[model samples]
Target: MPYEEENIQQFSATSSSTSHSFLRSRIGLVIEARETAAAITSIADAEAAGVEQIWMTQSPPTLDTLTLFAAAATRTTHIRMGTSIVPTYPRHPLILAQQALTVSDIAPGRLRLGVGPSHRPTIEGVYGLQHTAPLAHLSEYVAVLRAALWEGRVNYHGNYFNVHATLPRTSRVPILISALREGAFRLAGEISDGAISWLCPVPYLLDKALPALRAGAEASKRSAPPLVAHVLVALSEDENAAQDAARKRIQYYTALPFYARMFADAGLPVAPDGTGLDALARSLVVYGNEATVVQQLTELLAQGLDELLVLLVPVQDASRELAQLARLIGGMQ
Candidate 1:
C-alpha cells in the first residue's frame, strides 16, 4: 500500500479513548534566542502564560544554549527547560554530563537534557569532524552519558568513547533524544527518557514513530516514554501571511538532507531545491487565526502526541507575535 493509505488506516484504527486522552497532555514552547536578555524574557513570559515547558535549540552562531538555560533557570521558578537537542559530535559525553549536572544544580528538577547525533553536513562539513556511524556513535554516547548522569560514574569503553570518570553530582535530569527515523526512534525508546521530533506530520508520526518507539521500549522491557512533537506555529488573521511566514521560517530546514527525507517520507511534495511551500506548511505548520490554530493543535494532540512544543514563527513585530501567541495559548485553556 502507498504511505498515504497506510497513514489513513493507522489513524482510523486509533481508539477514540486514546484520541481524547491526549487532549490533556502537556503543551510547551520552543523559543529562539537572538540574545540572552530576549531569551530570558521569553522564557518568563511563556511560563507566565501557563506553558508547561520551554525548549531551546542548540545551533552554531547562536547564544550558547546551556548558558542561556542557566540564566533562564534563575529568572523562572516553575516552567521546565530543555535543550531541544545538543548535538553529540563536538561535545564529549563526559563534558555533556557535567554541563547537564551544572544546569540541574541551578534549576534542580526542572532540567531535561535532550541530545542527538546531528546531521552529517553540520557535523562533518562544518565542524571538520568525522560523522561515520552516527547511530553507533549515539548509542555509545547515550550509554556513557546516561551512566554518568544516573550512577555518577561511567567506566564504559565503547566504539566511539572510552571514558572512566565520576561526575560531580548525580542528576535525575530526564534525557530525550532527537529521533526522526526508525533507528533513532528505537534508541530513544530503549534508553533515553523520551523522544523529540520536528517537522513530522501527524499521520506519519502515528504510523511510523509511535510504533517504532513502542517496539524499542517493549524490546527492552521498559515502558514507552513521552513523544514530544516540535511544531512550527504562525498566528495571524490573514491565512496567506501566516503560511508565508511559516514557509520562510522552515525553508532552510527543507534544504537539509535529514529534514528533506522526512518530508518526502511523509508524502509531502518537496523538491530538491525546495518548492511546494503550501503543502509543506499545511502538513507541518500550525497556522491561521486564533480559533483555527487552536482547533488544529487540539486535533494534533488527539493523534497521540504526548507533548506539543510550539515554535512560534514570527509573522510581524516580534513583540506583537509573542503577545499573539500568549493570547492563543490563553484561549486553549
Candidate 2:
C-alpha cells in the first residue's frame, strides 16, 4: 500500500477522535538554572493552571532531565512528567530504558520519555560522542530502546549502540521521540509511542507527517502515538518583534548542523549572519501576540497534531507568561 493511504487506514483503525481530545495546550517548562524549590513551585502553579505535564528538557548549561523529572514528579502529584528530548548517545540504551522505567515506576502513566539524536556540536564538541549519520544512529537507538521497554528484554546490535537482554520497570511507559527528517519520522511510527516536535511547521505535519505516522503505526502493529509539539510562543499585535525573537532563536539553531539541515529541509531560508549565537537564537523561536500565536497554533493543530506542549520563552515575565498560558488554554475548546 502507498504510505499515505496506509497511514490513513491505520489511523482510522487504531486512533479515536478523542486522540485529539484536548486542544488547549498544557504548559511545559524548560529548566535552565531554576532552584528546585522555585522549579517545583512554578510547576505546581502550572499544574494548577490545568497544565498536565512538565518537561525536564536537556540542552547546554542545563541540569540533567531525568533527575529534574524525578525532582518535579515528587513535588506535583497529578501533573505528568516527561523528558523533553533525551539524546540517544551519552549512555547505554539499557541505562536509558532503565531510567525511563524507573521513573515510570515512580509516576506510572505520568511518565513519557522523549528521545532523539542530539545535534552535532552538542553531540561531539560538548558530550564528545562519535558524530555519525545521525538518522541511522537514532534509528537503531529507538528500536533497541522500544524492545527493551515493551518486552523487558532486547537482543539487538547496531552500528552505533547496542543492547543485551535486560528486564526493566514492569509498567507501561510512553516513549516519545524528537523527530523531523524522514528517517526519524518513520522510526517514530515503527518504534515510538509518538513524536515530540519543535519548530516543525504545521503544514509539514498536516501535509506529510501525520500520514507517515499512520503508515508506520500500521506497519509496526502499534496504535498511532500522540504527536506532541513543544510550542514556542509570544503573542502580540506587533508580531514583528515576536518574529524577531523567533528569528533570534533561528540563528542559533542554524549553526547547529542537525537543526540547520532540518530547517533547510523544512524550507525556511536562513543566511549565516555572524552576529553571534544570541542574534541567531532569535531566528529559531516562535512568537506573536495571543491572537497571532493562536492562529499559528491553530494551523499546527489542523495538521492532526495531538496536543500543544507550550514552552514559554523569555517574555514579558515568567509569571505573566504563565498567566497568559492559562488564559489562552481556558479559551480553547
Candidate 3:
C-alpha cells in the first residue's frame, strides 16, 4: 500500500477539535546571544516589549538551553521560556526530565520542554552517536519524558531506552517535539503536547503536515495538539536586500538531504547549483516594513498555527529591528 493511503486507513477516526490552554496563541521570539548577561538582558528586553515567550536552541558549542532559561528565570518574572529543541540522543530522558523539573521549579508554569532526535550528520558525525530509526527513537523518548514529567514516574523498557525512575513531583512542563515530515508530525500528535516546525513552508504545513497531525490525534482518540510555526522575519523596507541576507542562511539548509526532500515535497525543488534558491528564500522568509510583516503574520496565523516563533533576520541594526518587532506585536495585540 502507498504511504498516505496506509496512513489514512490506519488513522481514520475523527479527532476532537480541542483548544489548548497552554498555547496562548501569542507571538514569541527565538533569542540568541553569546554572553550570559547579554542573553538575560535580551530576555528582559523582550518581556518589556510584551513578547510572551522566548525560545532558545540547544546544540554543541552553544549554551545549554535549559540552563540558560533557568538563569533567566531568576532575572525575569513572567516571560515564558522554551527550548526550540534539545537533542534526545545525547541526554538521557530521565536526565532531561530532572533538568526540566528544576527549571519549572524556578519559574512555575513557564517552561515548555521541546525535544527531538536531530539529523544524522549532527548526531552521528558531531556527537558520534547512532541516528537510526529516529521517529521510533523520538516516540520512545517522548513517552519516557511525558511519563516522567507528567506522571512523576516511569517504569518500562523500550527499544531505544530502558528506565525505572521516579520524580519528586509531577511537573507540568509541556513537552513539544520538533517535526519535519508527516511521520514526525503524526508521532508528535500522538504523544507530544505540540509539534514545532522549522523551515517548513506555510502551504506544506497547512496542507500536508497538519492533516497528518490530526490523523495521529484521531488514531489516538484525542484532541489534536498545537502546531508552533517557526518562521523567518525581517523588519526592513528593502525586500531584495533582506531576501539576499535571508538566502545566505536558507541556502545552508537546502544542501541538507532532509530539508531538500521537504522543499521538494512542497513543490519547490532545490537545484544542484542553487538556481532556485532565491524563490525558496522568498517562499520561506517574510520581509519588508512593519505593515507588510504584520499582514504576512496575520495571514499566517489565520491559517491555523497555534503559536508564532519568529527568528528575526539581521538586515538592519539588531536592537532597532527588535524594537520594531516589539512595536508590531504590541500593536497587533
Candidate number of the best lDDT: 3
Cα deviation of 290, candidate 2, in Å = 4.4
Q: Write the per-residue lDDT of candidate 2 for residues 107-187, one digit (tens) a residue.
A: 777877888878777888898788688767777877787777777888887777656786844545667788776566766
Q: Which tens-of-lDDT digit does each residue in 173-288 have in candidate 3?
A: 88889998999899877887778899998999989999998888778876677787888998888888889888987898888878899889888878999988988888888988
Enumerate residue pairs that collide in model 1: none
Q: Among all windows of ten consecutive residues in candidate 3, which has the lowest summed lDDT?
A: 1-10
- Segments of candidate 1 deviating more than 4 angstroms: 1-25, 330-332
Could you tell which candidate, 1 or 2, scores higher by TM-score? 1
Go through the candidates in order and give each one's C-alpha lDDT: 0.78, 0.65, 0.81
Pick the TM-score winner.
3
Clashing pairs in 3: none
Model 1, range 1-333, lDDT digits (tens) per residue? 011223223323243544322343256777877888999998888877766577888877677788888888898997788888899998998898888889889998888788998898898888989998887888898889888988899999877889999987788678888988777788777887778998888887888988988788778776677788888788777778888888887788788878888878778857866677679887777777777877888877666776777888878887888767765664455
Q: In lDDT terms, how accurate is model 2?
A: 0.65
